[model samples]
Target: MSRVKESIEVDVPVRTAYDQWTQFESFPQFMDGVERIEQRTDKLTHWVTKISGVKREFDAEITEQIPDAKVAWVTVAGEGEQSGLVTFQPIDPTHTQVTLMMDFDPEGMAENIGDKLGFVDRQVKGDLKRFKHFIEDRGTATGQWRGQV
Candidate 1:
């Protein structure tokens, strides 16, 4: 398994950042390689991704969630095995620090090589940067789910 941890500061409140994150379907707007995400339920999400010409589909179950704080999930059924956590920290009334941590098993030769070359780390970092722009530009969450998991 390989692990990646990345963080970015966005010009938004913790609640704004956290609420925007809950809208899973909007991930494609900022998350590279993520073609689509479907929120099957409050605790389940289906994902479609294509990276370096490889396409994959997966289901991830939210293991923990706390509004304006953090969200965690593990793959339940998928083309890959992975788990991740995202946390939001309030830097101030109008700034938030968002961090993401992921653990994944690289499948096959190409994935293994990419992982070793730090591809995943770069991807996560880029995604967080895009997310910063996405949320800061919007200045409000597209949607929000406040339910506990």
Candidate 2:
């Protein structure tokens, strides 16, 4: 098991940040390794990702959520076993600090090699940076899903 974490502060509201994060399908706009995300249900999501030329598919179940605050999820099926959380902390009326944390294990050969070489860490940082740019450019989220499980 390996843990990779990164964070970035976005010039947006807490709710804005949270809402944007909820749009799983929009992840590809910032998340480099992600190819697509399907919001299957209120608490379920399917993901297809290609990283370092290796692709994998997975499903995750939202474990916990707090409006305008945080979202957490755990992978339930796929080639990866992991869990992660994204939290939105308001710095001001128009600024929010987004923090992301994930715990995962490298599954196949490519992932294992990539992880041991710090490739995964660098990618995570890159992803966060992209996310910053993405949210900043957008100014507001596309939509929000606030329903409970």
Candidate 3:
């Protein structure tokens, strides 16, 4: 198992950031490798991604979610499995500290090569940077799913 954690400060309200994150289908807009994210339910999601020329799909179950604070998830089932958490810490009313951690499988040669080359870490940081720009500039969410888990 490998874990990568990255954090960024977004110039947006905590709720605004958290709410935007909840808008799962819009993830592809800022999340670089995410080809699509389908919200199966409030606590479950299907994610398809392509990175370093490798494409994989996964299902994640949200284990815990606290509005404006944190969202944690574990892999339910998929081609590539992982567990991770995303926490939102309020630095101020207009700023939030966003952190993400993930543990996943490096399946074979391609996956291992990509991991050894620091491709994953760089990708995570790039995604966070894009997300920062996305939320700070646009206060409205792309879409939202408010059904209870």
Candidate 2 structure, TM-score to reference: 0.94
**TM-score of model 3 (CA atoms):** 0.92
Give a tens-digit lDDT track for model 1, residues 7-88.
9999999999999999999999999999999999889999999999999999999999999999999999979999999999
Candidate 3: tens digits of C-alpha lDDT, residues 1-149 = 77799999998888888888888788899998899999887788999998767788989999988887778889898888788888889999888999999888889987888888987888899989999999878876665544433
Writing each residue's lDDT as its tens digit, candidate 2 over 37-57 gives 999988999999988777889
Model 3, 89: alpha-carbon shift in Å? 0.6
TM-score versus the correct structure, for each prediction: 0.99, 0.94, 0.92
Ranking by TM-score: 1, 2, 3
Which sections of candidate 1 miss by over 4 Å?
none
- The per-model lDDT (C-alpha) reads 0.96, 0.88, 0.85
- Listed per model in order, the count of residue pairs whose N, CA or C atoms clash below 3 Å is 0, 0, 0
- Determine the backbone clash count of candidate 2: 0
- lDDT-wise, the better of 1 and 2 is 1
Task: For each candidate in turn, give its C-alpha RMSD to the true structure in angstroms.
Answer: 0.5, 1.2, 1.6
